[model samples]
Target: MSDALVTHQDIALRLAIPLEKAHEPRVNTLIQDSEELIQDAFAEVGRDYRLEVANLLQRRAIIRVIREMVATAVIVGPYSGARSVNSSSGPNSDGLTWDKVPEVSFAGVKLTDAHRRALGLVVGNDFAPSWNFPPATRWPLRGGDN
Candidate 1:
């Protein structure tokens, strides 16, 4: 897509998928979709991605986050609603399970707290003040220390 932040090549290299697979229509579509989701996330935090991440330093950081977001969407595909999957061979056989945390998984391409931080979006404690105020001065013993 014209405004896609990551290209098929980038996705392919990141996921170690065949370049041909990355060029498929599904992957291409996911690339554009992921970027749109990212833009929405930026807007949610009142940050204009194009404006705030234009600097060289910010660009590198934001791009890495964006790429990971897109890769996740592509990897998760359309079946993002399932939080966990369990497979077992038999009653007492080996089993494999995969689990995902909601905050970290967009189910497809959702923005994670880490992503917001990398983009400089405000999250808990990002703006927390650390200054220690001096103890309040006690009033003179007006009541004789009552």
Candidate 2:
């Protein structure tokens, strides 16, 4: 019944968490936070995305994106800011050495360009060929009747 595009059930499925686990208070907060982030992102772009989700297909697409966002946040957890673990090893003389740490981590979920496209928030440019025409008629310039 919440206004969030996705439900706890959806997040649970994505995260492979139990239904009861997904119902945890923190899970609900994560859902709300993800929804707000999406709304704010659209608002920043001067788009009323809520209005655009009127279509059933469009709504589903947005919901899918929101659910994924929440699930990602849950997987990352609040304490840990790691978006991905490149590689890990257990007890070695070499010890644990990170080849590279990402500049940004999934502390919070943000809409990606792919998500925007899937949500129909981004409009593709028309690549059809176009020509500029003179104000005057081309026939007249071609020596036709003025």
Instruction: Assess every candidate by TM-score.
Output: 0.61, 0.58
Candidate 1 weakest ten by summed lDDT: 98-107
Cα lDDT over the full model 2:
0.63
Error of 2 at 10 (Å): 2.2
The digit string of per-residue lDDT tens for model 1 on 1-146 reads 55545676777788854556534675667666656766787788677879755777877776687678767766664445555556676675544455554433443566777887777778778787888889999977767667
> What is the lDDT of every predicted structure here?
0.67, 0.63
Candidate 2 pairs with clashing backbones: none
lDDT of 1 at 24: 66
For residues 56-113, write the lDDT of model 2, one tens digit per residue.
Answer: 8977887888777667666644434433444446653333333322221345565666
TM-score of candidate 2 against the unseen true structure = 0.58
